[model samples]
Target: MKQNRNFIVGITAILIIMMLASGCVNKPSEQTEPTQITVSAASTLTESFEEIVEQFKIENPEIDVQLNLASSGALRMQIEAGAPIDVFASASQQHMNLLDEKEMIVKDSRTDFAQNSMVLIVPITSELEITSVDSLLNDSVKRFVISDPEISPAGTYSKQSLVESGLWNELEGKAVLAETVKQVLVYVERGEVDAGFVFMTDAKIAKKDTIKIISTIPTSTDISYPITVLESSEHKKESQMFVDFVTGQKGRSILESHGFTA
Candidate 1:
């Protein structure tokens, strides 16, 4: 009878142990989707923003960033047309302001983070002695390029500066209007044009042996870059964090490295 009691006790203990072990077992955790946000930035910001996005992802492993680079005005239109962009980094305050006026951007989120200087660039192989803005007026500069003022902030800045200098009337005839600042750089880098007006940041990325910076063009506008969270964004929380990441010290450091002033 004692042996039977011992066996029954052993079986009860074993059952209890199995039940406890089963209760303690963990189920596999469900993987979560990363928060995805799209950033629409000015063409001149391409290199700097790309680097920043890489670092931002390292620090924010949960958020994914997508970049769409173009002229500030063109980006503004995209936002106006209901594109699914979460953030905007514009080279022109005018474009940002238009968005704000239309309630397209988060009102309190608009802030300027960096400034850029417009520059005159020419092909490095060019034998022409293009020394100054006045050089563009020479008979030798047949085909110069500027981004289209309607779509690009760089073009507007360049045109405004030339108009203020009373050189627009003559240069307009020679100007080949491109869609973006990067296109202006390409025109000069490929020797497609005699010269081009582009941001100093864009000039920095051009091939070292292909393009040369002649001079910095002073603009009537402040030339500061403004960034904002879009009002239409579905992920405002994540979007705001992205704006913070860009306007933070880390982003400034990256921008400075790319010839932009923070």
Candidate 2:
């Protein structure tokens, strides 16, 4: 009888243990979904911004960043049209100003984080003796390219520099308008144009054997890049954190490494 009782007790204990084990196996584990934020930045920021985003991700593993690169003006238009953008980084103050004027950006959130210079680039194989902005007027240079001033801040700066140098009217006939500064670089790289104007950063990224920087527009016509959190951002805190990251020392280091001034 005592043996029977002992056997029953052992069976009961085993059943209890099995029940506890089964409960443990069936219990749900903790799951977390990362928050996503969209950033709209200019094409000029492609390399630098990508590096910055990577660093930001390491520091903020819970935040997922989505980058939308385009001409500053076009990005502003998208933000204005109510596209879901959490932050904006423009290659010029003009586009940021437009957003500020419309109250599309958070007040006091705008900050100029970097600067770039416009440069003239020619195909490496070209034998043109052109040396300065004035040389663009030479008959030998039949085709020159600049981003479209209507949508590209680099194009606007290029036009402003040419106008300041009293060469705008003379070069207008030979000017080829591109949609973005990268497009201008591509045109020059492919030898489609005699020469093209692009940001110094863009020029630096091109293969040395593919293109040559002939001249840089004076610094008086500086191109300032600004960043800001959008008023329409659903993840305002996350957007602000990204803005801080960009204006912080780490981001500056990345920008400077990419030939941008911070």
Candidate 3:
């Protein structure tokens, strides 16, 4: 009888141990840490790139994308200074070319993913009779704003358009230089400046009731946006994947929806 009791107790202990072992084996795995990739992109791409990152995360839940948005020239300088950037997307080919010349970009990684146009914008409530780029020369116009050509692609394009129109010298003295495109938009939106030159995409994102597009400037150079994975990237494969995603159909669709020419 004692033997039977002992056997039964032994069986119960074995069952409990097996149950504990099974629980441990069936426990959910520790959540995986997502691999992070830093992407330094032009400020003009803020909205579109944000959407693309969201969509990319749905498919690549294991990868984390961090965006560093700034003027393309400024971003390029950052990369040149070795800012741990995995990818770079420039609003103009000029900045990308600078990196390429320095061999900072990965071989064959540079791709033109989008295009944009420069536009003059003004506050909707403005009394100015400006309707075209030529109208900016009117005596009623006191001050105009543009991104600083030295550090902003939009500014460079704006200046290029003015120069092409034979108005750079005439308008240069009247121009209020902004550090970034968004600042140019702000100056226009607040009626702080008579008019401001910014990317069409930036204008589209502004409050319609506060700002109005005056005219599309004719640029001398193509306003193409190029993206590339940096040669200094530790996450080259992942960065390339991001570049592919931006240049792919899905990325193009998102960019187009945000008023960028894809």
TM-score of each: 0.90, 0.89, 0.89
Q: Tens digits of per-residue lDDT for model 1 on 182-205?
A: 988998999999999999888888
What lDDT does candidate 2 reach at residue 199? 96
- Count of backbone clashes for each model? 0, 0, 0
- For model 3 the TM-score comes to 0.89
- How high is the CA lDDT of each candidate model? 0.91, 0.92, 0.92
**lDDT, residue 156, candidate 3:** 92
Those runs of model 2 whose alpha carbons end farther than 4 Å from true positions after fitting are 1-26
lDDT of 3 by residue, 170-217 (tens): 989899999999999998989898999999999999976989888888
User: What is the lDDT ranking, best to worst?
Assistant: 2, 3, 1
Candidate 2 per-residue lDDT, tens place, 1-262, comes to 9999999999999988898888854667777888999999999999999999999999999999999999999999999899999999999898898889999999788899998888999999899988988888788989999999999999999988888888999889999999999999999998899999999999999966899999988745558898999999999999999999999999999999999889
lDDT of 2 at 223: 81
Worst 10 residues of 1 by lDDT: 19-28
lDDT of 1 at 224: 97
